[model samples]
Target: MIPTDWIYGLIGGVMIGAAAAMFLLINGRIMGASGLLGGIIDGTGKANMKERLAFIAGLIGVPAIVYFTIGAPATNVSNNMLVLLVAGLAVGVGTRMANGCTSGHGVCGISRFSVRGIAATLIYLLAGGVTMLVLRHGLGVI
Candidate 1:
């Protein structure tokens, strides 16, 4: 039998896909988190400040509201601040180099059958698997 968590995951994935579709159709923009946040930070999103702000607000606010209402979700992240900071910076740089992130490449890009998106998604999955193998088994640092 399918696990309860798998059902929840399926529902969440559907919701995310719907949200991405709606964002693209209504805003005429890809719902990429990295691009959205980067544009705001770099002042490139000034022309659509309201829309960007609304998107960001919803992104952050909805999760906070959900956590408060339904209780905080569990995480298994390392407590090391430096490790977290380095990881965050690495992801930022990687996304900038790739021209998009998981949301853009995996969801929006793949849905539109984009070559770049498919390539980036594959690279991301491969890199993630390698990282996990190295960290969890080779280094025992995870």
Candidate 2:
């Protein structure tokens, strides 16, 4: 049977694609999150730094806004804070090594019909699946 998460993910993908397409069409810029955030932090995307800051603020604050406004559903952490930190660091390292994150490759790259994007997307998916399998099933981390 199809998982509900898959349906949500498909919808999310369509929304992200639409947003990226619109951003590119209007701004002539690729909607890569890391680049945007980095540009803002480094004062590089300054022609629209105000707008960029607003966008980055929205990105970071939206989840908390939603949680506060709509209420947060409880989450049980199977791993400790240290594990979460390590995992985040690993993901950061992986993204740097790949030159982009899944969103950059899967949405922006694919939308532009880039072969590199396609290859990166496949690698991202395979790596994520394998990592999850290793963590949950093999290493019994979760």
Which candidate achieves the best lDDT against the true structure?
1
C-alpha RMSD values across all candidates:
1.1, 2.9
Report the C-alpha lDDT of model 2 over 1-142, residue by residue, as the tens digit: 8999899889978888887787788877777786676666557777888767776787779878989899865777545888799877887667666767776887788877999989998988898899889988999875
Compare the candidates by TM-score and give the number of the best one: 1
What does candidate 2 score on TM? Answer: 0.75
Model 2 spans with C-alpha error above 4 angstroms = 1-7, 40-48, 72-79
Candidate 2 residue 61 Cα shift, in angstroms, is 3.1
- lDDT for every model? 0.91, 0.78
- lDDT tens per residue, model 1, 51-124: 88999999999999999999766888889998899899999989977878989899999988999999999999
What's model 2's overall lDDT?
A: 0.78
